[model samples]
Target: MSVQHPKESWLIGDQGYPLESWLLTPVGAPNTSKEQKYNRLHGSARNCIERAFGVLKSRFRCLLKHRVLHYSHETSALVVSTCVILHNIMTKAGIMLNEVEDEVAEDFDSPNNAVDSSQYIREGERTRSRYISTL
Candidate 1:
């Protein structure tokens, strides 16, 4: 039998993470102008994504706790999609969530990041560098 691996993709991560080809982290202590620019741009993109998640969680308290949810992956996906649709409807109806009290944000990334194939690492690096150059 043969297995099919995922195609190469680029993902941005923050500090304290190992540099993988698929995951690109901001250059720590960026010395060169290009590196500094990359960091600035990457930070801006990550900030927008974080803010979107915060807003989603604020509106849908059900999504606040990840470990508490025990649904299958498909069910979880449906729940999130429903929440997003409902949020849009509420927004259009001029409804807004009263900010929840000091609620801690949940981690949203998948927990299955153990793919360490050398081929993937090399491809991920090429993808990240190419993507960054265009940014």
Candidate 2:
């Protein structure tokens, strides 16, 4: 599948990934009202992504908890792709996912994964600042 997005369009990312023209990251610390507002809005948007991942992992246990598939990188990719395709098919077919217990689901939101140390891009900083000003 091919996807096309405008240059100005963005994907919300956590602080693990650096800010980019097409990827927005949260402000490190909000010292002003505008920065605080921006951080709030940015966080709200980012949570949607986090929640989506949580749901995906909840539906497909193998993707996160089980770690049952041990294969070459290419094979692993194929496995993930297949799972995603199956997920979509199941969703479209109205197959309801079994409700996960709160205790089990709580682990999905744990911040145990290491965050990548990506460098900040100058243009991305400017874009973020401009957007915050508008807010």
Candidate 3:
């Protein structure tokens, strides 16, 4: 779902439900149209973020451990924050030690099931248009 904020569209999360099950357009016209569009797009986009976070947490063991910093709450907060920043930087730079992407499942859907064809044609045309436009 997408949240309407002042400056940005925020993707809340995705349910395990398939996109083919979703109605492409909103039930009500004009009034809820933007909302339905937002939900579908946001739901799709958030899946990427969910996968990225899962990768980060699973690969970075340090994120799971707590550290004492100067025996103070404020200092500990600072330390943890610093560590997280450093971790992100290292990961981005391809320096952090972690499991390879090849071993991880990047797709947000179930592995065994084949791609559902109900929405494939429309989705493909949208994708193709986007792809061609980028050329």
For each candidate, the alpha-carbon lDDT, in order, equals 0.66, 0.68, 0.43
* Model 1, span 16-58: residue lDDT tens: 4545666776655555677667877777767766667678888
- In terms of TM-score, the best-performing candidate is 1
The pairs that clash in candidate 3 are none
How do all models score by TM-score? 0.66, 0.64, 0.34
Q: Which of the two, 1 or 3, has more lDDT?
A: 1
- What is the lDDT ranking, best to worst? 2, 1, 3
Q: What is the lDDT of residue 54 in candidate 2?
A: 67
Candidate 2's residue-wise lDDT over 12-51, tens digit each?
A: 6766666776777777766789987887787666666566
lDDT of 2: 0.68
